[model samples]
Target: MYNIGIDLGGTNIAVGIVTKEGKVLKKTSVPARAERPFDQIFADMASCIRQLFAETGIKESEIESIGIGTPGCIDTEKGILIFAGNFKYGKNIDYRAEMAKHFDIPVYIGNDANVAALAEVRAGAAKGVKNAIMITLGTGVGGGIIIDGKIFEGAYSAAGELGHIVLISNGEQCSCGRKGCWEAYASVTALVRQTKAAMLANPDSIMNKTPLEQVSGRTAFDAAKKGDKAALAVVDQYQEYITEGLADMINIFSPEVIVVGGGISKEGDYLLNPVREKIKSRVFGIGLLPDRKILPAELGNDAGIIGAAMLHA
Candidate 1:
């Protein structure tokens, strides 16, 4: 039977029909218009699902379940979204009840990062592994942990927030209201901030040519590739920040694989290689155990949908 996966984001609500093996058969999306009431957003999601059903000529009875991957805190046991930073009015939303109003199929919900990790373990980079960790370095860092091939939500279904772990005390402030969070140093947003600061310090740097407002996650990496000293410094420091957290994770969990996702991971080996090399010295008992693999995520954007669909698996 087919499963429905919904990737609910600030800008869009993407829905897909996925097979048991995690392949998306058909997908469609609608603008989330997050400023509106939660009921309106739910209505749009239901309407989109109906449209998918009509376009694919699939009977409702053929669907096994509907799962959602959403941002912010999720109470999966009750299918409630506790809080979402992007939405204007999403608080303690009973998502399962909302979906129940439209479809009788079983409903499941998970934190977006958690589901992405699940997708990787089920069909992407860590497909064959039973233990893995996924880190998404976007506006903020997002993390997911898998143990024994299942998502570990901890006691409150709020575990695996690896980004909030502090790497430096009283250093850079984080959006999460913490000081020196790993996200404050290792996220793509952090990279942009670092690039801007570097350009400001080195007026003659190649990166200075771009307006500060235009500085992005790639600014430093691009300039560094061109052999710009200031840019290289920024990239080097950012890589070290990433490695510090990775080493901590390795020492704590010792997972078989750590999958890197999000915009910055697109840098591929340029990013992974340095982090992997540096992580070697930081992990505990480094040479005594088999080397852990740090790999870029393979599924890209599809990871959220495929992972959400596999919630039933």
Candidate 2:
């Protein structure tokens, strides 16, 4: 009658009872306490699940399975959390086996971004598309690729790392010890850095009114709206960086649709329209194919949870 989806993140763990249609019927959350031992972390997870079932009066027999969307590489076949930047453990945290010990239902695991992409394709922006990519512009750029109505994890479940792709040669350094990574240029981190740099360069820019520590992704857009030349320049440069990465992805996969999500995505059409234009003309062989559509993600944070639940699909 229902499924359970758990979104396990560095700072929080959210559990939800979901319907077959990908609707979250009941949900609860707690601090992730990620620094603790993996077993204790999972004990917290199991406890949260028990609380949700009790509150909703949902029985184990009525549940089809339990799924988790986590931040890191995942071995979907074995339901292991291979490696996560924010997670304390590294390599082969047997999440499925551990969670299964506490529940009778099948347990599955997937990369958080991949599961969110699945949710978008199944019930959000790309609902009817057979192929799509979901890009999240947060502290860093995160992505998920979908093909033929299924999540494409690639061999070793390490594919779809769209952000790590090199965008410039010998360019900005990335957290992954690489240079010119798409993330280093197009992520919110880069945007804020760009905004601050611009503010410092032009002391009279409208952006100067904002504190240096508060130069957010929106600073440029807001100041640009007020006709600040410095701010507008930053917005233009950031958009160009984003477009370059998107064009590369289109050239590689050319998915039928791209769903952009995350904090910066709240800019909506102001962001999608320009990126759409660049991708349309820049992707290889664009003269023969229909324009690939770029749409904002519909499900927001719930995409991961709903998608995790649908892992059994």
Candidate 3:
């Protein structure tokens, strides 16, 4: 039997047909345009599935279930997306119920981070590990926690919000309406802000060559490679903060591995190596590093859809 995975994000809706082994056989993408009517956007999302069905010629009866990874608080028991910051969805949006009008398959919903973690453990970076955590750094921060081989969502499917943890008391305010959140310091958004702040200090910095609006998470790393002191400082500080945050997570879970994903993970070793070393140095207990490790995520963007499809697995 096959499964359908839908990745509903802020700007795009991606639907795919996935096999039990976590491979996507067919997939398509469409604009979500979440600012429009909820039902309308959902219709377009459903249409993508229909288009896939037509192209693949797969009968509805062959599909076992449908899994969705959404960017917000998911009421798993109710299949309701409680809220979505980027998607602008409100509470009580019966997402599964609305989609049910189109197909009769079983539907499972989960937080994007949690679902991504599920995907990793099933077939990606953490495949063989018993316990792992996935941290996705993007416009904001998203995370998933796994313990004893199952997702540890705690209560209300809100347990793995690793980004909102207090990092620096009374420091930068976060989108979650809190101050000193780890997300405020370690996210790509925070990296951009940090790069900009350093650029303002060093007029002759290599980053000045680019428009301020175009400066991205890679700006500091790019300029630092050219031996710019300002850029190097920003990179160092960013890594330091990320190290502390990883240390905090290590203290809490001490999982076999910590998987880092999202746009920033593209940096690969340049990012993961330093953070791992720092975490190794700062975490509780003093001794040589054991089997615990921090590795960059392997699945890339497909993690969302594949993980979503595995919801029923």
Candidate 4:
């Protein structure tokens, strides 16, 4: 049977029809309207689903279940979004219950990061691994851990918060009101912030070519490729911080694989090579290193939808 996957992000909601083998039969996007009322957002999502089915000629009867991947600290059992920094109105939204009532079908809800990890474990980079971790370095760092093919939510259903782990003592400030979080250094937001700070020191750097508002990991990477010494130095510094924190995670969890996700990771070896070198240089247990592969995420943006679909199936 087919499955329906919904990836609800702050900017857009992506819905897909996923086959059992992990192929996407159909997919579409709709504005999340985070600033508007929640009811409107829900209506838009339902409309997107209807439009997708109509365009694809896929009967709802063929679908076995539906799943939603949302950004936040989610109470998976209750299917409620406990808190989300992206969506101001997402607090305590019982999305699964509401969707079930509306569609007359069972619904599963999961954190976006956890859902991506689920996707990787099931069909993507970590496919055959019994233990794995997925880290997405975006606006903020998000992580998920999978052991023996099941999600490892803690007793409070809030485990796998690896990004919040302190990498430095009393260092940079984080959006979560914490100081010295790994995210404060490893996230794309942090990279851009650091780039801008470094740009101020080197006024003639190529980083100045990109407007501050539009500066992203891509811009920084492009500049570094063009022999922009300042940009490359910033990236080196960022990679060092990421390696320091990731070494801790490896020493603690020792997962078989660690899949890196998000826009920065799209740079492939440009990002992965340095991270791997640093992790090996700092962490102990060389045998553990043999089993670990610091791989780029294969599913890209679709991991969330693919994983969310598995939640119900």
Candidate 5:
């Protein structure tokens, strides 16, 4: 049987027909148009799903379930999107019920980051692992935790908010309205912020060697590779903050694996090696420290869609 997975993001909605073995048989993308009415976005989504089925020549009788990964807080049991900042029109929408009404199939929905992490655990990087945590260091840091192969959604369905955890006392403010959150200093946006600040501080530095618009994680990597001191320093600073957060997670959860995903993870060993080393060296319970291995996410962008599909399982 086939399963349908939908990645309902801020910009676009991606749908796919996935196999039981986690292979995507067919996939397509359509504009989310979140600025428009919720009904319009839902209609686009329905059309996308129907197109996917037609392309795959799969009938409704052959489908097992449909899973949706949406941004923001969600009431999984009720299939309601409580607060999705990306979609101004999605708040309080009963997505599962609506989708079920249109498709007549079992529907499952959850927070996007949580479902992405769950997908990696089930079929991506963390496959075969019993316990792990996932961190997506993107525009902001998003987190998810898996224990015994199941996602640990806290009592309020907001568990695994690793990024919002306090790292510094009354320091940088976060989008969550808190101060000194780990994400404020460890995300890709944070990296860019740090890079820009450093460049401004040392106008003569090689970072000023590149155009501001071209500055990104890769830019930092390129400069570091060229032995640019300022860029190296920025990377060092970012990694230090990231390590502190991971070390705390290691101490608390003792997870067997930590899967780092998102654009920053493209740095691969450049990012994972140092974070792993720092966690190993600094964590409190040294002897009892779990067999923590930091690995890059394998599924890339598809993890969210694939993971969302498995929510019904």
Candidate 6:
């Protein structure tokens, strides 16, 4: 039987018809226009699902279940979106019941990052692995932890917040209102900040050619590739910050693999090789335990849909 997956984002609601093995048979999306009421958003979701079925000529009976990967803290058992700052609508919205208004099918909900991690473990970078951690380095750092082939949602269904761990006391400020959080140091936002700072301090650097407003996560990495000394220093420091958090995660979970996703992972080995080398010494008993592999996420944008579809598994 097929499963339907919904990737509900602030900007778009993406729906997909997926096979048991995580392949997307058909997919489509609708604008979320999140400022609207929750009811209207869900109606659009149902409409999109129906449209997919019409386009694919698939019947409702062929669908085994429907799953949604949404932003914010999710009450999976209750199907509630506890809080999502990006949405104008207030918290505690019942998502499962809302979708159920359209279809009589078992629906599951999971945090977007968690589902993405599930996608990696089941079909992407960590495929065939029973235990893994996926870290997404985007505007902020997002984490998904899987143990024994299942998502490890802790009490209150809010575990896997790896980025909030403090990397330094009284250090840089973070969006989570914490000082010195790992995300404040290692996220792509932080990388851009560091790049701008280095460019300002070293006017001769290759990155300074770009206007400060145009500086982005790729600015430093791109300059470093050309052997720019200041840019290289910025990249080295950024990688160290990333390694610090990764080492801590390794010491804590010791998962078989760590899958790096999101925008930065696009750099591939250029971004991971140095972190891998640096992590060797930081992890405890590095030689005694089998080496943990770090890999880029393979599913890319499809991970959200594929992972949401597998929530029942």
**Clashing residue pairs in candidate 5 (N, C-alpha, C atoms within 3 angstroms):** none
Q: Which is superior by TM-score, 4 or 6?
A: 6
**Model 1 lDDT tens row, 1-313:** 8999899888888999998888998999989888998888888889988998999998789999999999988789988999887666469999988888888999999999999999999999999899899999999999999999999999778999999999999989999899999999999989998999999999999999889999999989999999999999999999999999989888888899999999889899998898888888888997898889999999898888899998987
TM-score of each: 0.97, 0.97, 0.96, 0.93, 0.96, 0.98
What are the per-model C-alpha RMSD values against the true structure? 1.1, 1.2, 1.4, 1.9, 1.3, 0.9
lDDT of 2 at 242: 88
lDDT of 5 by residue, 144-229 (tens): 99988888998768788899999999999898899999999998888888988888887877888778877887767778778888
Off by over 4 Å in 3: 288-291
lDDT of 4 by residue, 257-300 (tens): 99999977889899989888877867777655474788989999
Lowest summed lDDT over 10 consecutive residues: which window, candidate 3? 283-292
| Segments of candidate 6 deviating more than 4 angstroms | none
How badly does each model clash, as a count of residue pairs?
0, 0, 0, 0, 0, 0
* Predicted candidate 2 versus true structure: per-residue lDDT over 137-220, tens digit per residue: 998899999999888999989898899999899999998899999999999999999999999899999899999987788999
lDDT of each: 0.91, 0.88, 0.87, 0.85, 0.86, 0.92
- State the lDDT at 253 in candidate 2: 85
Best candidate, TM-score-wise?
6
Which lDDT tens digits does candidate 6 get at residues 1-313? 9999999887888999999999999999988898998899888988888999999999999999899998888798988989986667569998878888999988999999999999999989999999899999999999999999999999878999988999999899999898999999999999999999999899999999989999989999999999999999999999999999999988999999999999889999999999999999989997898779989999998888999999987
C-alpha lDDT of residue 257 in model 3: 87
